[model samples]
Target chain A: AQSVTQLDSQVPVFEEAPVELRCNYSSSVSVYLFWYVQYPNQGLQLLLKYLSGSTLVKGINGFEAEFNKSQTSFHLRKPSVHISDTAEYFCAVTPRGTQGGSEKLVFGKGTKLTVNP
Target chain B: NAGVTQTPKFRVLKTGQSMTLLCAQDMNHEYMYWYRQDPGMGLRLIHYSVGEGTTAKGEVPDGYNVSRLKKQNFLLGLESAAPSQTSVYFCASSYTGMGPETQYFGPGTRLLVL
Candidate 1:
């Protein structure tokens, strides 16, 4: 079994300021981590994912995340934020075995990012 | 291309009323999933299907049932609606079983129970 935890519940930042959303996970086996963003009343959009080979992964919208195995963390970061970046972000994880099917994804409670101008 | 589509964008249900939400994907993907999003909480998986005629339970599946009669479609059913079941429902699809699992999501259906 795999579970994810997002440290912050809400973060308010001024536009153009840098932001970091922390995430941690617990799993007995290898795991795959992902970050997703949801706009107001909209479905989720994939922010980034950490599969293998690279600890730092980049995604669309100038967002990036670094996977640290020892720390059990996959934190998302952006050098600068925009007002349009205001939304809810979720971190998810799944184990890496056959029994760990692709059907299941354990998610964090989510962190609401409010970018104010 | 409509990667994924969910029917009934919004609905209001009374207690004990039953309804089914339909999700379809034109991507010919091998994996499909149903999830619910609520305030303060992130999305939780309700059910999923890996292929045609195959279904599996997810993190929160007690109040829901799912069917995958065909590869292109997955249906989520509420046998008896309850206030606790009101949330935004999303459907997603992925292409394969490994590496950088990028699942494309639908627009989502907002359901309110009163």
Candidate 2:
């Protein structure tokens, strides 16, 4: 089984300030990592994903994440945040190989990001 | 495309009552999933279907049942509602069950059990 841990439960930042949300995972096998954002009363949307290749993967809204294998971390970072960036963010992981023709993603408890004006 | 959609944006049920939540996707996805979101718990998978007529239990599936009669539709049913079952339910679909395919999600349904 795979599990994800989001180090922070909540993060607050002033507008135009840089921010980073930490995430770590534990799995017996190789895994894929992802970051998702959800606005109030809305469903989650993919912010970025790390399947393979470059350790630094960029996504929409000027957000990027670095996949650190030795550290077992996939931390999301944004150089500058806006008020609109305030939302709950989730980190998820799924095992690399397909087992029993089924795939499931295990998510972290979530980190609520508040970009204050 | 509508992507993924779930019916009954909000619902209320009493303890011991029964109800079903419907999920529909027009993206021609082969894998569908049901999940529940609780405060401070993020989201937990309830059930999932890799293809039509094939439903599988997920991390938290004890109080729920699922059906996938059609490729584009998945239904989650609660035979007997409990106060612990009150939470936001989300449905998601992906093109395939292999690799790192992206999953598209619906708006979600908020269920309240009293």
Candidate 3:
């Protein structure tokens, strides 16, 4: 089984300010990481994913995340944030496997990002 | 492409009432999932279907049931609604479980159980 932990329950930042949301995961085997964003009353949309390759992965809305293997972390960051960026962010993970025909994700407790004007 | 869509964007049900949420995907995905989202608690999988006619319980599936009669459709049923079940429900689908497959989500359905 895999688990995701988002250290921050909420993060507030001024407009155009940089922000980072911390996420860590625990899994005995290899895993894939992802970041999803959900606006109020909407479903979650993919921000980015770390399947393999470069540690730093860029995403839409000028957001990026770094996958740190040793630390078991996949932290999301945005150099500059806007009011539109205020939403609930979730981190998820799926184990690397072939036994199961499909994979189910384990999500974190979520981090609410509030971009103040 | 319609991607993923869920019916009844918003619904209200009294305790002990029964209802079903429908999900459909046009992406020809082989895997579909139903999840509930609560404050501070990210989405938790309630049930998932790997393929048509096959459903599996997920992390939280106590009072809920699911069916996948067709490959592109999945339905989540609440036999008896409870106040605790008043949350946003989302549907997601993925092409495969193999690796690097991203799950596409629906607009979500908000159910208020009183």
Candidate 4:
């Protein structure tokens, strides 16, 4: 079974400081990866995704993630973060294949990103 | 557009009671999903609908039932609610269930089974 692991449960950073949230996955087959953000009391919003090609994937709000196949990791990062960027982040993976089967995304436990001013 | 909306932003149910949570989307998506968000467990899929009249079980579907009678609506029912069933429910939809497709989410419904 495909699984995702978010290394950090909480990460606190000073305002305008760079940050990195580590994510790793275990899958036997080819997989697609994604990062999602959830604000306080709100639903999730897609940050970025890695389907194929381009190891570096850029997402909304100046965030980017590098998909390293060898490491089985897709880590999210931002050059600088604002107070509004403080939210819970999730890493999800979906194994390649949709022929008469569920193509559901398997999510990690989540990392709470806190941008302190 | 309203995008995706879930009815009854919050609900409290007693054990053994039955209630249904409704999820509606306006994007004309062919794929809809129901997931329960629990602390430390992340989001686990309970059920999904590929199209109208077709529903499938997901990773965690034992305590829930679903119906997709209409293209825009997906209902999740708990025949006999349990305290363990309490969690934040999210509804998501995508154009298709293929690789890398984005799933638009609803605000979510907080259900408490007391």
Residue-wise C-alpha lDDT for candidate 2, range A1-117, written one tens digit per residue: 888999999999999999999999998889999999998888999999999999999999999999999999999999999999999999999888754123568889999999999
Give the alpha-carbon lDDT of every model: 0.90, 0.93, 0.92, 0.93
Q: Which stretches of candidate 2 lie over 4 Å from their true place?
A: A98-102
DockQ of 3: 0.63
Interface RMSD of each: 1.9, 2.0, 1.9, 2.1
Candidate 4 overall lDDT versus native = 0.93
Q: Give the C-alpha lDDT of model 2.
A: 0.93
lDDT of 1 by residue, A22-96 (tens): 999999988889999989877788898888888999998999999999999999999999999999999988787
Ranking by DockQ: 3, 2, 4, 1
Candidate 2 pairs with clashing backbones: none
Residue range B1-114, candidate 4, lDDT tens digits = 999999989999999999999999999999999999999999999999999999999999998999999999999999999999999999999998886789899999999999
Model 4: CA > 4 A from native: A98-102
How much is the lDDT of residue B101 in candidate 3?
76
Better of 1 and 2 by TM-score: 2
Q: How do the residues B1-114 of candidate 1 rate in per-residue lDDT, one tens digit apiece?
A: 778999999999999999999999999999999999887788888998889999888889998999999899999999999999999999999997554578889999999998
> Comparing candidate 3 with candidate 4, which one achieves the higher DockQ?
3
